[model samples]
Target: MSETIIAKRYAQALFHIGQERSKLEEFESELRTLQEVLRNNQALYSFLQHPRITLDQKKQLVNESFQSFSKEVIHTLNLLLDRHREEILSAMVDQFLTLMNETKGIADAKVYSVRALSEGEKKRISKTFAPKVGKQTLNITNYVDRSLIGGLRVRIGNRIFDGSVSGKLDRIERELVSNK
Candidate 1:
């Protein structure tokens, strides 16, 4: 099976467990921290992937490093390590987060503006756009992009609502050229 398929399966199982235990948010946070560590530490990633290392040793290291994590998360890691599927850890976490967000009626959104947006601006954007995307609310992450010239762009999932000045100019230019 493809890595993504495997990851989704594992993620679904974990998501169910989280829901049953009423610890979905806790697991999501812990999983994100683990994913970040795996992403930022090449050596640790290699160590986990190394064939020479024993499973016990890898589990020991993982346990020591993530001692503060919940038992469910730690057990999941150990299970993955034992099965030699550690490489899919990040993907699993991402799928799990997606499931959690969907269950909570939340969507992750990216807001790009010429300048940093205030809390009020973010809230306004979320209120205006979240319903359009069939979500109750948006978890907005803002980015400052001077290239936008002015205004902002909002992306939720595969849809992008572009209100930037540059976007407007491009659309007008396209219409003018097409009319010729």
Candidate 2:
């Protein structure tokens, strides 16, 4: 099976467990930390992926490194390591976070503006866009991009709502070209 499929399956299982334990948010946070650790440490990831590393050693390392995580989270990591599927850890965490967000009626958004947005502006954007996307709220990550010229461009999932000055100018240009 494909990696994504496998990841989704694992995520679904973990999500169900989290739901049962009423610790979905905690699990998500731990999973994000695990993903971050893997992303920031090449040597550790390589060690996990190395074929010569014994399964027990990998499990012991994971246990030592993530001693503070919940039993479920550690168990999941060990399970992945046992199966030699450590490469899919990030994908699984992503899928798990997606599931958790969907369950909580939240969407992750990226908002690009010419300058950093104030908290009030972020709240306003979240309020305006969330309903349109069938989500209760958006977890917005703001990015400053001078190329935007002005206004904001919001991305949720695969859709982008471009309201920037540059975007408007591009649209006008396209229209003028098409009219000719």
Candidate 3:
């Protein structure tokens, strides 16, 4: 199977376990924390992925590093390590969070603007765009793009709603060229 399929399967299994234990949010938080730790700590991530290190040593290190984590998460980590699929850890966490957000009627959105957006602007964008995408709400991540000129470009999943001045100019240019 492909790595994405494997990651999705693992994520589904974890999500199911969380549902059964009534710890969906907790598991999500833990997975996010694990993802962040792996991203921020190259040494630890490298150590876990090192072929020279034994599985027992890796498990011990994980246990020591995340002593406060629940057994379900720790066991899942050990399972992944034993299966030598540590590289998919981040992908699995992403899939898990996606599943969680979908269940809660939330969509992750990226908004690009010429300048940083205020909280009110973010909320307005979310309110205006979420319904069009069939999501109850959006978790917006704002990015400043100097090339945008003005207005905002919002991306949710695979769909992009481009309202920037540059985008409008490009569209108009294309239309003029095509009509000639």
Each model's lDDT: 0.93, 0.94, 0.94
lDDT of 1 by residue, 74-124 (tens): 998899998899889889989998998999999999999999999999999
Candidate 2 on 101-171: residue-level lDDT in tens?
Answer: 99989999999999999999999999999999999999999999999999999999999999999999999
- TM-score attained by model 1: 0.92
Cα deviation at 24, candidate 1, in Å, is 2.0
- Model 1 root mean square deviation, Cα atoms: 1.6
Off by over 4 Å in 3: none
Write down the RMSD of candidate 2 (Cα, Å).
1.4
lDDT of 1 at 139: 98
* Error of model 1, residue 49, in angstroms: 1.8
Indicate the worst ten consecutive residues by lDDT in candidate 3: 66-75
**TM values, all candidates:** 0.92, 0.93, 0.98
